[model samples]
Target chain A: MEDPRNRQYTNDEITVFWKPAKCVHATTCFRELIEVFNPGRRPWVDMSAASTQRIIEVTDKCPTDAIVWKYNKDLSENELQASTSTSEEVNPETLSTDPETKPAKVTIMKDGPIVVEGEFKVIDSNGNELKSMIMTSFCRCGGSHSMPYCDGRHRKIGFNDKK
Target chain B: MKEKSAQFRVIENKSLEVSGSFEIFNAKGELLKSEGPIYLCRCGLSENKPFCDGKHKNSGFTG
Candidate 1:
């Protein structure tokens, strides 16, 4: 079983496992706490960047269990095996290639960008097809120089939903 | 019901033109929009919220 994408990070108190294939770019981890789960940094996740309690709080917010954490002592045999063997559990995503399933899902993140996930097509104002994607985040605070796509400008600008 | 396709058009820094059969939920999991051909605010200054109300004009809201 060749699992090159499986990455594990530890901080003596807990271990965080990452499954890249399961990531839907929900941005919860980075949006909530970027110090630990920065996508820009190589190896991408730094468990030592934050406290174990803070890391757990952000990791648990992942919509898909792409990133999961377990206490050093609480990890069961199966969890340890999870790092080496591919689990038989299948995560169902609406973005599957099934054309007859349903419409894509649009979810607004709390005080963050709008996360659009599932099968969908994007077109420019000129009606040109931009790119088809299963998951993407759109800027809601209208500060992204990248236009519609989120470039994490909302956080820099301190975008607030209420006031 | 027949399957519906989702389409999003970036309307030149004004708004996002979204169409097709879909449901939109806010951060609180509340249904925001669930219909067709709606212009969502892109300038972050919509008084009406989420939906566009032509506020992009004069807001210096460049892409």
Candidate 2:
């Protein structure tokens, strides 16, 4: 059974599943491709905004499987039935940004980047504040093209934590 | 007065300096020994693993 809060968006080729409960708000979705996943917009996901291939790329970038995609032809019977009815849309903007200050949680992913969540600030080497949302991932691998931020290059470069 | 938020500083061509209130967990989700003002390895050359072992200088890591 699907969570009542879950949402699915479909284009002619694929369907993107969104599970809000699983989101750690790593901000990868909108940060990389806001054209399709804008939190500020109603019906937050617009499958028509971008090509299916482009959409798939961004969906795969989600740190937590908060959003995932599948080919339309591969949909299960239950999924096909569910698609007949419209599901209510919920935006990340609706998710509460707690007012109270608390200790941030930083987790190091094996062979990957450093994931940080909760309240915190990011400063560059020059002491300038970098814009941050609820959460973010930092590059641990020496080869990230986007310095400081993880562009999912750790996997490509074969970073090993134990080494 | 509100407490200062935790700070993550990207030290130029070096480790990431993290300060203020925060808890760091290893890949297994076990809480690691994270005292405030810790410098985490970013160059991926640290023999110490997550913590900086000053190897970035020798490795010529420029990111």
Against the true structure, whose lDDT is highest? 2
**Predicted candidate 1 versus true structure: per-residue lDDT over B34-56, tens digit per residue:** 78788887788887767789988
What residue runs in model 2 are displaced by over 4 Å at the alpha carbon?
Answer: A1-12, A17-95
Q: Write the per-residue lDDT of candidate 1 for residues A45-160, one digit (tens) a residue.
A: 77777889999998899899888988878887866666554433322122244446577788878777767766678898899997566666677788876667776677789987
lDDT of each: 0.74, 0.81
The CAPRI-style docking tier of model 1 reads: medium
Quote fnat for model 2.
Answer: 0.90
DockQ of all candidates, in order?
0.70, 0.70
What TM-score is obtained by chain A of candidate 2? 0.60
Clash pairs, candidate 1, are none
List, residue by residue over A51-149, the lDDT tens digit for candidate 2: 899999999999889899999999999887776666566556456566788888888877777878778889989999977555667889888777887
lDDT of 2 by residue, B1-63 (tens): 665678999998999999987889887779995568999999998888788999999688987
